[model samples]
Target: MKLQPNLLLRLGFRQNARLRHFTGVGTSLVYREYGDPQKVIVRREDVIPKLKDDQVLVRMLAAPVNPADINTVQGVYAVKPQLPSVPGNEGVGEVVEVGKNIESELQPGNYVIPRVNAFGTWRTHVVTTSSEIIKIPSDVDIAMAATIAVNPGTAYRMLKDFSPLNSGDTVIQNGANSAVGQAVIQIAATLGVKTINVVRDRPAISVLKEHLTKLGATVVVTENELRKSEEVKSLPQPKLALNCVSGQSGTEILRKLSPHGVMVTYGGMSRQPVTVPVGAFIFNNVTLRGFWMTHWNKEHFSHPKRHQMLNELFQLAKTGGLQPPNHSLVPFSDYHIALKNAMPREGMLCKKQILIF
Candidate 1:
């Protein structure tokens, strides 16, 4: 049949429109107002809208409850979302359907993760534009893939961007037992950089030190030990210091820097300001900087370096060079448990909580 080009185009559009008509309902955790995450966020089964020509329907596999997610819900994070929002910032999912006009490489059954924040990943399904998500290796561990975008990416960027580190170069950091801290130790080790990890002294300090050591930390010391330990003093002064626990701990890390060193503060677990000594800025020529992963993502959303870093992290996860931190998987139905476990409790070490569908 000889058809006009315009008629052919119209027919194609109709077929694609028919494909977009399919719809279903899915579970989501929604919040109408910012408050306590556990208080305001509630579960609801909402109708999943029909797919648009450029969108894909993803069936979520798992998502983690991060501290930032809690802060966002509490209206304390630097960036805020409009009310009646979903909470998760990152997760991994499978593409169950694709709109007929999607031009990207995404396809049914491909694994993907949101490339940006505020994705509202704490849901059973989502219909997102193909451009908003990026495909991940289907073979990688789902839990590791779910977490790869943030903590490990933070570790990777901090090491590569802040300094020109060579093999045997030393880096010092507090919050050594944190997820990001663990990532720092492993990534630094892979680059042949030595890390002097610092953590608060706890009842099970030995176990914690041994665990970090096995993950490639060159040295793990309690906050008190960091000040007086001769072993730490024997190592070359670190050219870089990572501060997540700002306050007295941050000050101590600053005191240990080498000449012309840089200290990059990425977190304030202590909720205190990073106080730099006058002598450090004047005498040693050290620089103090801050990093927010969310801000970094906004700046580098389309930069090649962002994807390059992600690919490297994926390879590390596949090869076992990078491992997901201590975590406990809670069923999606037990979201309350996940929320409760994710909250900070005095004197208790909390394992990351992942909600599995």
Candidate 2:
């Protein structure tokens, strides 16, 4: 018996005329080592990836160059893959085709974002299962939509999990300049919660404070002020604190929390271990926990929950409550320039840079 067209599609295929005349190939960015951007290898038109029976084809739209994405390439993240692997962790794409037997809640032309592990997204397209893709709202801009996966997802999960936030309650966090930190400030504001943000003292402290305050932060304190703030005693003691910078910075955040409050640590961007005072654990009843986006996505939440969470985020974005920060857009053809521009920088200029395909 001959295989049906449906069966052929199910086995990773489409009915293009080229399917009969030529081989399909996809181009991707691959990195083999931990070093500078020059170390990255751009392999174009390598192989046109085929979808499995349960998978769909996503035409790449836009993807951001996040710190974690860079870290993965550097082999610093906990989830390092084998050498010469594709390098993007999150991206937004449109479903161009679906396998015949694929039963996806997602449809072609719909914008979808996915957090697939080590399956390089710095490509013209990606082939992944329906389980990995989250349908995005129609109104969300595809460029801003590209940033929805890791940073925003981390901020949302941490705020929701660390403690129950109420109106007028305040949360403290370091790395207030990070993308996730900014999202936390905005989301907390939208929820009627307040934020006490901490950052290193820069030359333009006033300007930085104003920027954060505009983002809904109740208070913006330098690291030095955080330690000496007799003012914090009068304010509502923070019930939740987020620490991406570790070491003494983390300890200072813990010191400011209310009794029995929790501090959730996500990243160690400071390259320091969080040091906690013995008194915080023994007397204050404080709990210290860690959050890793990969761990939470893989173990705690199911695929459906991930989709639902993103849907809620989109609703917030559409309402103008959870707006994304200013972004620099680079075309896919200029990916080399974009890659160079994405290097770790010290000063403030562009907050987030996204690669537009």
Candidate 3:
């Protein structure tokens, strides 16, 4: 029998009685020009394009207001989108309608996440292909599912790729309170590895330390404290260092690594280049490398291990071994508030804000 596109969509419309099923009008946060996100992001609504035989229509559930999303909007990120682009990088979405000829692997009501880094997600709906998205467990926690791409995925890869660590082994990282850093702590805890998390001193230092400690950080200390404390000096030297804040903060963490240690640079929050003493590299034989989740995904998207890694992470999330980052919600209409919260500011590091459709 010949396939029929109109009838397939017509039947899908009958199955799901939502109004958008027909009109395809949906909202989005768009930026025609790149700069500061707070000034450029605006709300727009339009009819979603018709789906190709391989495409699927998805209703965005929740999209994270990630720092990378802000950086991308500023035109400073390593990866930049074409002009007049939609502005979010990661989120969980529900499959609302599938193209008539789409593979049975994707179906209406299934959950999915973007398959690539720059698949803009700050919208109420998305029209994408089976090749552009990967199915996720429908019952997974929304917040956790929305954020699994960049942050936790980074932590998981760094932990596995760097130094050869085993049960009872130790790793240290700067930006201890960051989403990725917390994932490091929790993942290490689950694997019987220890984490020494270093954060900058702030008024809320004690509270942050307490929170990270509860997440299984073996030791949480300020940059200043890490440099001066005898207590920190007593623990087993770390074989791996994860640096998100490059600057003296990264140097402080790098200086604490054990001989033959490896430091992986994944982000530069402090906007300062990583600096280390010559002796540490020469005598300690320390190695430096960098990891960008974007690049990794491009290289490994079809690798069998990619799914294995995600399965492990999903298991952790389902079992409560891994938790989502602390975050506040903003309805899609109030995206400006989420954008503003994502910017760097005084006071102390705070929870990320997410856009709820």
Model 3 lDDT-worst window of ten? 11-20
Best by lDDT: 1
lDDT of 3 by residue, 1-357 (tens): 122346435433333354324444677878999888888888887677767777788878889989888888899888778989998889988887787888888887788999877788998778888888989888798889989878999999999987888998889899889999999999999999998888888888888989999998999988878877776777789999999999988998899999999999998988899898999988999999999988888999878778888889999999999999988878878887887778888647688888887
Residue 31 Cα positional deviation in candidate 2, in Å, after optimal superposition: 1.5
Range of the 10 consecutive residues with the lowest summed lDDT in candidate 1: 7-16
lDDT values, one for every candidate: 0.88, 0.78, 0.85
Off by over 4 Å in 2: 1-25, 49-53, 229-234, 300-304, 347-350
Tens digits of lDDT, candidate 2, 274-301: 8999999999999999998888888744
lDDT by residue (tens digit), candidate 1, 21-52: 44556889999988898899999987777787
What's the distance in Å from true for residue 45, model 1? 0.9
Scored against the true structure, residue 243 in model 1 reaches a CA lDDT of 96
What TM-score do all the candidates reach, one by one? 0.93, 0.88, 0.93
Question: Residue 107 lDDT in model 1?
Answer: 83
Better candidate number, 2 or 3, judged by lDDT? 3
